[model samples]
Target: MTIRTARDAVTAAALYLKWLGFRDIMQSPERPASGIDLRAPGLVAQVDPTTCPATLRDVECLWLNGLSASAVSVFFSLAGYADDARAGADALGVPLFVMDLTGTPQPVNRPADELVSTGAGA
Candidate 1:
């Protein structure tokens, strides 16, 4: 569950978003100044999966998200960046979502039969 790189963090965020019904989630090109990760075009989510420490300014992005279009921030818990990320999100007035990589599994069941079942009356 230790995310080694930003890419790993982003991938995790993408999966979580997909689970939340955000399809075709795409990430932005890695840039020095973008300060963002995944971007779902129509969705008001500006993902910033950072392994480094966050600052007060970083938190502002969360608030910005709300002001702009109800964007949400997703952070992957790295070495010690959780506090900074949280603070940044709080300051920015955005809801921060953290994945529990070490927590117990809470399985979500999906009906396998539905994948292939075309029922007129089965």
Candidate 2:
């Protein structure tokens, strides 16, 4: 589950979600039109494996997409999220995770912390 490239990050994120008990997870195609990287029943996820931190706009887009699907949103980032992004996600109730090189997801905020504690049902 080591994350050395962008593709590896996506794979790792998917595996992590599986470990969290999400079944039948669907990974978005490359250059997904919805900007979502993964989807499962009641869940929507985005993974950003670039050096730049995820931005507020990024989280908002995920949120909007999830809202359209009536699902909860989560984010995984390699370098983590911008300050504004964190604030926005917190207010929107989106869980944010910092993806470690080992592909482990570390909770970045209260919502994420709750998710980690509650796993898939969260």
Candidate 3:
């Protein structure tokens, strides 16, 4: 299955976030350079299509944005993340998610810790 609409992916990310107990989820403006794909109080997530495997640079941007906003960082890729991106998230404790073709979100790594905390605590 192929997802043609980025909005659809955003909505799906919102739904998945809702399942994860995020109540203030909303879509961010369409800014390819420096905008979050989705936002919730205390949380910020970016979504990318399967064709676009999220990279470390993407993770870094999200991490910085979240820090500036005083929120936890998250990333969602329909396909997956690069090795460095995974490492970066793990190092920084950013939650990484991958969505299916049907828009169901899957966590790439769920460390047994309670939450994806701030870098200071990570």
Candidate 4:
């Protein structure tokens, strides 16, 4: 049961959200340099597999918008990228959710407090 990349995770997330009554709001604009991958009504989500510095800023914007809109903010990533996602979410005062798309859809929602660790100290 090898886990795949974050894009795969996000695609799985989109399918799950659809199953849970969410429609496909928007897709990436196919820009090679764009940071945002998808944009849904009331929610902004991203899939990250690397510690790319750009992801932090991108997630921050998503977090702020998601918070303002009272949306269920999410970041789907491979296990390795969880820390980076959490850090970005914390700085933006938003929640970072984790979804194990590799198996049975085990999703974990980490609030700001829980993700604020001394090492990462948000």
Candidate 5:
């Protein structure tokens, strides 16, 4: 649940992507830098299981990597985030996903007003 390993994060991220309508998803949670945790078509998602606070640099690197591949950027962190990381995500209009003890991912920072018609539609 706390997602202690990259493998665990990979499973969680993959499930999250599936719920987003991605039938085929790739995961590489342990890999660093441009290494992505989940990907499908035009979406690129990454997961951070680090115990320390996720930072702005982490978001920036993920954002840059996703852009290089012309994919939408998504971030998931089990360890929460630094203020700059959260702020940067909001400014960049990215979804900042956080996992609970059950390893379920939710977009904690993506505003409800920005919500499109996600069939889950919550």
Candidate 6:
């Protein structure tokens, strides 16, 4: 299914997480007060459904949230990410993925590649 809306993005993200072997996945409200889109055992995820690409602040926020929860963090963006955001994600070891319209998220960085190879255990 084409991900045309935020709700579609959330649904796709949740499904993708499931495919990645993440169990007990929990989705946040359409507009989550915490800005986190999803969560699972040992994981925290942020999905950017906006037209604007995710920025460095976005990446950092995801990292911070995950750190506070003592879980690994991942990011998904429909519009992709800014250069600085990518750099920050790389430095922070936060996995980054580009959420294509097909509802499949493609890895955008090395950490993300590792995540794909290792599944949820990473």
Q: Which predicted model would earn the best lDDT?
A: 6
Q: Point out where model 1 deviates above 4 Å.
A: 42-52, 69-88, 91-93, 99-122
Report the lDDT of model 3 for residue 31. 45
True-structure RMSD for candidate 5: 3.1
lDDT (Cα, tens digit) per residue for candidate 4, span 7-98? 55556656644554556556565523434455666556665545443256656766765677676555554443345655766665554544
Measured over all alpha carbons after superposition, the RMSD of each candidate to the real structure, in angstroms, is 9.7, 1.0, 4.2, 7.4, 3.1, 0.9
Those runs of model 5 whose alpha carbons end farther than 4 Å from true positions after fitting are 1-4, 111-122
Better by lDDT, candidate 5 or 4: 5
Q: Count the backbone clashes (under 3 Å) in each candidate.
A: 2, 0, 0, 0, 0, 0
The local distance difference test score of model 2 is: 0.90
- The TM-scores of all predictions, comma-separated, are 0.54, 0.95, 0.83, 0.53, 0.82, 0.96
Ranking by lDDT: 6, 2, 3, 5, 4, 1
Candidate 5 residue lDDT tens string, 10-72 = 787777667666666776535855757777777777788777878998888878877888877
Clashing pairs in 2: none
Give me the overall lDDT of model 4. Answer: 0.52
lDDT by residue (tens digit), candidate 1, 1-36: 344555666677666556556556777667335455
Clashes of 6: 0
Best-fitting candidate, scored by TM-score? 6
Native-referenced Cα lDDT, model 5: 0.72
The better-scoring model by lDDT among 2 and 6 is: 6
> What ordering of candidates by TM-score runs from best to worst?
6, 2, 3, 5, 1, 4
